[model samples]
Target chain A: MDQFLQLIVAGLATGAIYALAAIGFTLVWQTSQTINFAQGEFVMLPAILVLTAAHLGLPMGVAFIVGSVAFVLLFGFGFKRFLVEPMQRHGVLPLAIATMALSVLIKEAAKNGFSAEAQPFPSLVPDGSVSVLGAAVSVRDIAIFVVAIAAILGLQAFITHTRTGRTMQATAQNPTVARILGVPVERMILLTFLINAALALIASYLISPVYLAKFSNGETIGLAAFIAAIVGGFNQIRGALAGGFLIGLIDNLAAAYVSSAYRTAVPLVVLVVVILVKPEGLLGRKEERTV
Target chain B: MLFKTMAAAIALTAAMTVSAVAGTVKLIDVIELSGPGAPAGTNWKNGSDLAVAEINAKGGILGQQIELIHYDSQTNPGATRAAVQRAVDEDAYVVLGPIFSGPISASMQITQRAGVPQIVGGEAAAFTRQGNNYIFRTSLNQADSMPKLANYLRDEVKAKSVAVVWINNDFGKGGRDSMIPELQKRGIQVAADIATESGQADFAADAIKVKNANADAVFVYLNEEESARFLRAARQQGIAKPIIGETTLLGAKVIELAGEAANGVKGHVGLLVDAPKPTLVEFGKKYAAKYGFTSDHNGIKGYTAVYTVKAITERIGKLDREAFAKALHGARIDVAQEPGILIDTKWTATGDVDRESFLIEIVNGKPVVKATLPMINP
Candidate 1:
């Protein structure tokens, strides 16, 4: 029982980090209708930036914020120039290739520029573990989980309340109609790229301490995010959260109940079953496709 | 007619002389000068450069300066094979490392058929004793080292219940496979042996399993990247048992990534302390001055490999591959490359070398030399 509760806490905390990464993936997919395979690279920005800042002896917080905002803009501009422009003329395949290429480029650049060695993010939370029930939970895990939940809620509020968010949604619903209604489709698409990049940075900042900031961590995180996006239905924001938590739960539970060797494999199995049952995802709505 | 024939003979003699000195030995160093997961603070580039530099500075071997041709393999196996082939095509007399087990294994066949003496810098046990005289390593093989790991767990730490976590690659798999049988023989109860993917960032699930298994110690075998992440995740999940494994964890990244959590982890590595070897101290001081950081296992391995080549080359006095290979076997040199000051024996066999891996534990957040365990076989 105690062990079970421990697994749940550990899984939920990890699930939150995956949720943030998945949300970024979903945003790019929903707005652009093309997956930015480099979405994980955007997520690794803050950690790299922080590392760079640490090398320069800048304060951790300042370095993180500057790095996060700078990368968000850089990635946003890249999407606008490379992905959106190419997709407007040619097709989505080019955009996919471009994003994957970007992923490789960004990974190599980070390794060469920031030093490929794994560097720790300076700890923000106090080093302590609190006993909840019989399971001991580290302060860092709790902080990460709380930050993830807060970010998700904040994003939900932004989408529901903000004019730009609604305009972005309007653009997603019908790009032609949204343009007819004076919604800047190009600008909204750019905004989506920025949002995805920013969210990815946020996720990196939260997760780097828990998982050492690796040069190729983006690929690892990206794969989990892809799994989450698929399980949650790429079109549904709530689906991402659901998918992330479900995958995380299955990962932990499987390790405990089954075999640790299949920790990653088991979650994938559950995701496949869920996808089979509901092709639209757990909370996703069916969308009409254009021929 | 006599005058024309004398002119032709003089020209022919000049051509023949030019071709004779072409016997100058060209040794190719296929080492990784830069790549991901390289050892911390290692000057492999400089170490490699210094070997050639010293050899050239001392004057040409057989009237030809040893030419060191280097190509970065990026520690990839495919790249390594290509690099080896390039070296062979370039007519290199001998080839030295593109470190990392996979690359070393991949390039073994290429060098063997070409009769090029390939001095590798990795210790994966599966890589050794390939039934070819061409493949040789100064680094200790897994079969030779892993039994010592099991012995350390039983005798040094007195660990009873042990859980093993490793990457599924040849390096990790070899270590895990060798240790398990030996560990069982020591009457140690094996707990959970969890395998994780190489280059993975999140290891929370694996950490939980280790915690749940309640093992007294966790033996983790992975490259630097995954090992560092695993340590951080294990700490976050509150799974604290003295983590010990391969020498790769002694890198700066591992210590930096794990930070406070890296305090007590133990690992196996070549002895780094200063001993009677005058060259080692001189090399150490020079390396620190050149690279602006302290040396790691790779620096020593690279330095020692060059020294071994020099010793063997000096003994043979000629660039014969078969002769050099024969000299490498159990050839003893008393010069100090590592602390405790003894080469004691030259690598007479692929399985045994004059190498000793000292037990290292993190003391004060740094890898301090612990007790030295003599080679079980060598």
Candidate 2:
């Protein structure tokens, strides 16, 4: 029973990371109607940048801020403006392909600029394990869970209550109508990219200590988040969050009970089952389209 | 007329001496220079570079300057094959790397068919076991080392049941296979044998399984980063059983990444940086000065590989690959000239080096040598 509880807690902590990354993916897809395949690379960029800054003798807080600002300016503004926006006119397929290319470009650039070696990230919370209900849990894991949940709740509130947030949602729903209503649809899409970038940065900072910041880490995290978004329904933010948690839980629990050899395959199996059984996902709504 | 004839003869002798001094013996190094294996590959290159510098400084190998040609395998098997073919095409006197098992295995047919002597740093026992006469290993094969490790766990640690978690690659799989038989031979129960992907970050499920199994010790065979991740996860899950790991887990990178969780973890190491050997000490200091980081086992193995080549070439008194391979078959290096990194300092007929395995435990985020095991015959 303790083992069961431990697995669940571990799953949730891991799920929190996936949830944050999934939310970022869902946000960009909803706002621009184009998938940002490089969403995972965005998460990696901040961690690498912050690690580089910290190595250059900057304070941790200052390095983190610089990393966040750099991510926003480069990926959010520079990437969206020059690459994504130009391809947007060509269609969603082209834009998505461009993002895929961008993912490779970012990965190679990071490898060349930094190193292929995994760089250790300092733990944000103090190092130590706390026993909870017969299970030992790291304090950092708890901090990650709390921060991820808080960020999700804050995002939910902003989407529901804030003017700019609602305007962003309006643009996502019907860009043509939103633009006609003076919502500045282009700016809203860019703002969505900025918000997603910030979310990715937060996830990277939280998880780097566990995984170690590496050039290729983005691909693993990104693939999981991508599957999470699909499983939760791409249209809804809360659904994506729930989907992320489900993946984390299923992945951990399956690996524990079943064979660890098939741990990586467990999530994919769940994805296939979800796609076949519930095409709309657990929390996604079924909407009819006029032909 | 006699004076002119003597002057011509002297001029001819001087010209011949100058030509002999200027002639070059080319060696090819095929290694992964850019990818997942780059860190270790870079160290391998540095080791060879240091050896080449030292050899040339001491009046060259057989009076001919050694010219090293390097090819980046890019961590691809296909690229490694091409590099080996290129080495054969260039007629390199000897070929030095392709450190990972996959690349080495992939390019073995090319090197063997081309009749070029290839010295490798890969630890896969199967590399030399395949009846390839020309291939030689500078590192201890898992087949030979893992038994010693199992014996240590059984006799010294008194472990009865052990759980094994390994990466699902050639190195990890080979290590797991090698360890299981030895553990079984000692009547130790195999609690659980789990294999995970190479760069997997989450080890919660694996750790939980090990904890539930309640094994006396855990044997791990993941590369440095994944090893750290597993250690962190295991410690978090409160699995406090003594963890016995593969040599890859004892590096500075693993220690840094695993932090306090790495404490008390014991493993087999090829080269312990803290070992009180003058050769290793001097090599470590020189490596730090050149690379700005302490040399690990890979760097040491790579350095030793060049010396092995130098030893063989010097013995045979030529740059012929066939003769070099034959000499390496029964060659032995004196510990006085070379570092005592390899135990017996000799190669078996199969081209695998006979080396003693060293045990190390992580104390305060650094590997401290515990004991040097009795030499295991190849």
Candidate 3:
């Protein structure tokens, strides 16, 4: 039983990272009606950027913030220039291909700019492990879990309460109507990209020390988050977050109880099952047969 | 009389040029110089070059000046195979490297089919002994290296339970698979064995499982990038057990990236880091002077391999393929240019360099000599 509770805590911490990454995926899908295959790379960029800046003698905290800001700005500008314009001119698939190219470019650039070697990020949380009901839990896990939950709450509030948030929802609900009502759909879409990149940057900073940051670290999150978005229903943010947590839990439990070799396959199986049972997803509304 | 004397002078000059051309030994170096695998190749090239430099300085080999032709593989297997074919086309007597397992395996088909001799650095032991007499590796095979690690865990660190984390590639999987039976033989129980991809950076999920398993120590087999990240994450997430690592962790890059986290970690290294033999020390000093940087195992392995070729060539006294193989198999030459303590051994008829290994320990943030294990041949 103690081991069971411990697994849940550990699962939640892992889920938190996936959740943060999944939210970014949901944000892009909600506004743009397309998935950014490069979203995971956005997460990895800040960690590498912070590591580079810190190596150049900047304070770690300042370097992290600067890195996060740089990724956010890059996402906004790049989306406006390459992603949005080409997507508007061509179609969604072309933009997806463009984002993939951007992903490959970021991976190679990081490998070239930074040494291909892995570096340890300084830990943010305290380093003691506490035993609760016979299971050992570290302070780092708690910090990751709390930060992930807080970020999710903040995102939920932003989407529901803020002016830009309402405009984003309006654009998502009906892009034509939102533009008719002067919602600045293109600008909202770009802002959504910014929001997604910033969130991913935040995830990178929080997780780099605990998770390790490699040039391809971003791709792991990006691919997994794509699966989570699909499993949760691309239309709903809550569903993405829930799907991420579900996948994380299933992965951990599968590794612990079943076979560790099948760990990767478990989350994939979950995605497939979710696709079959609830095409609309847990939080998503089923489409009406209007015709 | 004056015209006849001038004709004699011209004839003498032409004869001397022919003799000088006849005396040069044609050696080809197929080294990985740049691209994704440059880190490994760069060091190998330094070693190979240093060896060539020293040989030339000592008045060449077999009374003929040695000529070295080099082609870079860029760490890609296809590129490496093409590079080997290019070397063959250039009429190279022997081929030198395709450093990692992937490239080496890919290039072996090309080299083996062509009946060319190869001295490689990659440590997939099975790759060298795959019934190919033309292929040989100076590096310890993964099979030879893992038992040493298992011994270190069982007898030295005294960890009873160990967790094995590895990348799913041939290198990591081969190491992990070999380690299991060896560890079991030593009475050490494996708590968990997790496989992740080479390009993967995050191991928090895996780390948690390792922690939950109550493992006393962890064995990590991965590339430099993944290993470094795994080390950092393991440290940050508070998995405070000792990490026994594979040879890839020997780079200074691993230490720099892992920071204090890597300080006490124990790993297996091919070359001892302490003051090597006096001959190696002198060579190192001169190499540092040339490259403006210190030498590592990859470089030294490269150096030793080229000289091994030279030494074998010198003992053979001729350039026949059968004679060269016979000399390489039976010949022994102590290389003064290597970093660790290495004694010469005959290349087995199977075409593998039979060499001994010493154990290196990184203590208090310095790689120090812990214990020396003589050669244990299978």
> lDDT scores for all predictions?
0.73, 0.82, 0.72
Residue pairs with colliding backbones in model 1 are: B329-B347, B329-B348, B330-B346, B330-B347, B330-B348, B331-B346, B332-B346
Model 3 DockQ, alpha carbons vs. true complex: 0.26
lDDT of 2 by residue, A1-291 (tens): 877887888788889999999998888878767788998888888999998888889999999888889888998789778988789889889999999999999999999888877878877777666888877766766788899999999888988899988998899889999988999988988888888877888899888888888998898899989889889987789888999899989888888887666766899988999899998777877756565
DockQ leader:
2
Q: What is the alpha-carbon lDDT for the whole of candidate 1?
A: 0.73
Chain A TM-score values for every predicted structure, listed in order:
0.93, 0.96, 0.93
Per-model TM-score, in order, reads 0.88, 0.92, 0.82
Judging by lDDT against the true structure, name the best candidate: 2
For every prediction, compared with the true complex, DockQ reads 0.44, 0.53, 0.26
Q: Whose DockQ is higher: candidate 1's or candidate 2's?
A: 2
Report the lDDT tens digits of candidate 3 across residue range A27-58: 77666656677788888888888888888889
Q: Candidate 1 on B1-378: residue-level lDDT in tens? A: 999999999864543233224755576777764444344213455566665676678764555676677787876678778888998777676787866777788888997886667887776777776776777775677777777788889988799989999887667788788889988999988898887765566677777778888988988888766777777777777777878876777654467567777778886765342423355567767767776665555666666666666667767876666677877776666564322122443475662465556778877777776767665545
DockQ of 1: 0.44
Deviation (Å) of B332 in candidate 3: 2.2
Worst 10 residues of 1 chain B by lDDT: B336-345
Q: Kindly indicate the candidate among 2 and 3 with the higher DockQ.
A: 2
RMSD of each: 5.0, 5.7, 6.6
Let me know the DockQ for model 2: 0.53
